[model samples]
Target: MNAIQIKNVTKRYKNVAALHDVSFSFESGKIYGFLGRNGAGKSTLINIIANRIFADSGEILIDDLPAKENIKVHEKIFCMSEADLYDAGLKVKDLFKWINRFYDSFDLDKAFEIAGKFNLDTNKKFKALSKGYQSIFKLTVALSLMVPYVIFDEPVLGLDANHRELFYDLLLKDFQHNERTIIIATHLIEEVANIIEEVVLIDQGKVLLQDHVSTLMEMGYSIYGPAKEVDAYCADKNIIGYDELGNLKIAYVLGEKTPLPKNSNLSASAMNLQKLFVKLTEKGGI
Candidate 1:
């Protein structure tokens, strides 16, 4: 299969397990929202995939080929990490030149073009740019590369609302032009809710769920009404979390939503991506 398959990958720091038997695939020609809470092993798994760190057990495969320390895999994947991995002393343009020299698939013209769109001063040393601009610079390089699988770890970090929107717009436009696997590991779930076709939610160093955005949207909903009615309606349902206000109650549930009892006072409302994420991660369940 043309995908990045993570097979029973495990990582630990001394006694703490960063990832435990993590197995999933980032299939080709799709955009994935890799959602996870802080310290949920998102970065650890990403680092393993990028070969920046080694997994304690198991392995990662990119398009059926071994991913770790493989030069061929280097051309197949690009990871835009939260940490700055570039030479701070080098000017942005110079760094672009260096990346161009390294990756045969990198488009130098597109890099400059994106830099222009972001108003990134290519002449400034990487260390001289502001935090947000530094993120822009890194994404600029990632966007310029036409690798089969690209991972963006917190791509919008430090970016203001306007810049973030611009980045999403540009990303969608880029994806529309060229289809590939784009894995976005970010906590800003609602921001990429619409952009992502699928969601791979991780919690407490383990995958909580992996489903299509539409399926999750359909399966996750809230039942609201009098506490008694809500409780009655939610009985035997996959209730993930809940909220209450005096006599009223709201049950956040996962699974096929059924119609309310005939003319019942209870109501079913669709749960948004952010709400679903919060509810599931809060309860770490169903």
Candidate 2:
């Protein structure tokens, strides 16, 4: 299959299991929101796929080729992670040149073009760039890659609002022109809600859910009304969490929403992606 398939992948650090029997696939030619809260094993999974770390059990396959330390699949995938893997003294343009030579799929001209769009100073050393500009440089490199599968772990970290929006716009434009599998591992769910076609949510080192964004949105909703009335309406529903404001309450729920009782005070509203993610991953009982 032309996809990144992970089968029964398990990873442990002494007593802690970063991932446990996790199985899922990121299909070809789609933008996926790889979402999870902190310590949800997102980074662990990405590292494994990028061949930075090995899984204790199972395997990672990119289009049926093993990804673990395999050079053949290296050109097929690119992971732009939070870690600084570049030399600090290298100028932005020099680093781009280096990466261009390292990866057959990298486009040097497009990398420079993207840097221009972000107003990134290609002449400046990486260490001299501000935190936000550093992120811009990284984004530039990732956007220019012509690889089939690209994994972006916090791709917009330290970016300002304007630059972030520009990145999103450029990303969409790029995807529209040349379709590929884009796995965006990010915390800003709302920012990516419209960008991602599918979502794979992980929690507590396990796969919580993986579905089309539209379907997940359709399945999640909130019921709002007086505390007692809302509670009553949610009694038979799949309530995930709740919120209260004085006498009023809001119940975040999964499953199809039914019409409220005739003339009842209860009201239903669609749950946004971020809210749904928060409720689903919150640690305590709700």
The best candidate by TM-score is: 2
* lDDT string, candidate 2, 157-273, tens digits: 889899889999999999999999999999999899999999999998999999999888896888889999998888898887788999999998888878898988988887777
TM-score of 1: 0.85
In terms of lDDT, the best-performing candidate is: 2
lDDT of 1: 0.90
Which residue pairs in candidate 2 collide?
none
> Candidate 1: which stretches are off by over 4 Å?
221-270, 283-286
Provide the lDDT at 193 for model 1. 85
Candidate 2 regions with alpha-carbon error over 4 angstroms: 222-269, 284-286
Instruction: Give per-model TM-scores.
Output: 0.85, 0.86
